[model samples]
Target: MPRNPATTTRDALLAAAREEFAEHGIAGARVDRIAARAGVNKERIYGHFGNKEKLFDAVIKDALDEFAAVNTVLEDDPVAYVGEAFDRYREHPDLLRLLMWEALHHRSAALPDQSWRAERCGRKVRSLAARLGEEPSPDVGRAVLSLLGLAMMPLAMPQLAELLGAKMDTPESVAAMREHVMGFARAALEGRASASG
Candidate 1:
């Protein structure tokens, strides 16, 4: 029999899966545990998501979508958007960490049928191009990549960032770092802008 669609159980499962995959990575995550956390039967996970990899993919896509919704608001000013992007990432530290964990562990499981990652990059490229009144230069791509990298790499390598004297993970430190990096990024994006302006 088909389960009723009115319950919040699906939402619960996705949330639990996000936390689990964020912590455990693909190989470490277990459907039974996700189901248990969601208060659903283990079989229900299979019934709903079809498999573990799909569940993780859904979680990642959802996270990316949520991040984009917040960070991509100032389309006319991507340099300013970078600050907001940093703020969004700071508020949702786990999402970046989860992506990092997946990368570090080399979990190559296919992330569903969606490639929101590439789509997001493309959107950034277009946004950067629009801000510059022309196609974005190679530097723009590099800057956007660096902006994301700077935002994420610190958290991904806390000890290393700390070793380099860039303390991350603290609320205040992260905010300061975001401001500093955004300033640098804005300068790079608008290199010829009058300093007085």
Candidate 2:
């Protein structure tokens, strides 16, 4: 069945809100600018989402929901899952950077409860636990968390490498880092070394 135009309008507002929040933190994102970017009036945004803060929360949650929909974490192999997750982040750099920026600035707390995050994290945990063929372990969560951090943190915070006295942006540097991180992540998650002699 055909969808209502209101749904499209809401999606547009959410997309515009994401751009505004990602470009400028929540404190700087404005309803007028978001409305102009969406090609809708500010009143529509307010009427639909209530206010700027609520809209920002909705935008972030919507992005997260879309990402969760991809469900790449279903891979049974931890290394393959890490590689695929890295690819997803590589393809959608904005989402990773936006998340990083939010975390670094502690803006997530300003939005609403973190039950959403806990839920998302819980899903990953369940998927990983099944893959490992045993009960969920803290190591599983840590492995996934560390893998994502390794793959995304540098891109999310480009200055992180410079701060650590390394150039992490170049192709060679990036490739090397990816290899190291993936290898370490595989070993860490599987709790074993490669079988090569």
Candidate 3:
């Protein structure tokens, strides 16, 4: 089946926007450049996304939604959850860069759709808590956040990882780090559960 031109254009715009935003951030991204890279007219950006800020929000929402869809916490094998997250970040490094750019640009201001994002985060924390045999609480939330941060660290900051003795560019090193993170997360969660019990 032939693809719809509008959908094709939208996808291209999004791809171009991801690269731009990942490299330059929201404030620095240019609609003209995005359009040129996407091979679509500049007006299509406004027609599709309303404006630059809205387009940025759409880009980030799509990236995060995709990430959330692919990664899940497993009750039986929690280590696999962390391993899968690390793999996801390895495969989609741009997402981390885009998120980092968003954080840098939105330093003091609240992010767009804060309530929706928070609700999604709450769900993940609850899921992680369930896997750890605990109810959702501040500790569970912190654990969830820590595990995710650990998974993303090597990809998000290759230079730092390298400086700290991790070979961020090597598949073997990444696999080893993934195993270590999974073991570390498992122990931490188990320790927390024991402490609470």
Candidate 4:
């Protein structure tokens, strides 16, 4: 089957825009550069996304969709779940950069597409709750946040790892850290489960 030319162009634009936005963020990303990289006219961006802010939103939505496809939280082996989440973040470095840019730009302001973001977050909380064998609640949501922090904090703050002489610069070192993080996370979950039980 043939794919639509419009879809192909949109995909190209999105791929190019992802790299541009990841490197420069929304305020710094240039439509001209994105178009040039995507090998399309800048007008196509306007035609497809309406404006720069809209394009950023599209990119964000696209990134989230990508995550949902590949970053499922596991119901079994919650510890392995944490390890896998860390692996996923390592695989998608730009995602963290995009999220950091969003946080810096939005501050306390509302997200570009608040409802959609909320839904995605809600789904993750539910998934985390399932891993704990509990119904979704505020406590489970907090656990979800903690587990995600465990996964991403290392990559997000690599300077601390380097300053402390932690082993994370190499692939083998990262794999070791991933196991440590998983163990750390599982201990937390076990402590809570024991206390509650």
Model 3 C-alpha lDDT per residue in residues 77-124, reported as the tens digit of each score? 667778888888888888888888877775477888899999988987
Report, for all candidates in order, the number of backbone clashes.
0, 0, 0, 0
Name the candidate, 2 or 3, with the larger TM-score value: 3
Query: Each prediction's Cα lDDT score?
Result: 0.73, 0.72, 0.84, 0.84
- For candidate 3, the per-residue lDDT at 54 reads 86
RMSD of each: 4.1, 4.0, 1.9, 1.9
| Ten-residue stretch with the least lDDT total in model 2 | 188-197
**Model 3 worst lDDT window (10 residues):** 69-78
Model 4 Cα lDDT, one tens digit per residue, 1-197: 99999999999988999999999998899999999999999999999989888888888888878766653455656677688778878899998888788777764667777888888789877877876778989998888788888988898888998887774978889988898899999899999989978
As a whole number from 0 to 100, the lDDT of residue 175 in candidate 4 is 84
Better of 1 and 3 by lDDT: 3
Decide which is better by lDDT, 1 or 4.
4
lDDT of 2 by residue, 1-197 (tens): 98898999998998888888888877777889999999998999989999887887787787677667554564466665665666667677767756755665554343464876887787787787787664567866775578677666656666766788655667788667667667877777655333311
Q: Which regions of candidate 2 fall more than 4 Å away from where they truly are?
A: 1-3, 69-71, 104-117, 162-176, 190-197
In TM-score terms, candidate 1 sits at 0.80
lDDT of 1 by residue, 1-197 (tens): 77766347778899999989887888888888898999888887778778887787778778877887863543476556777776776778778867776566554665454465767677787776666665666766775677676556655677887888988757888878878877777776667445313
**Reference-based TM-score, model 4:** 0.90
Candidate 4 deviant stretches above 4 angstroms: 107-109
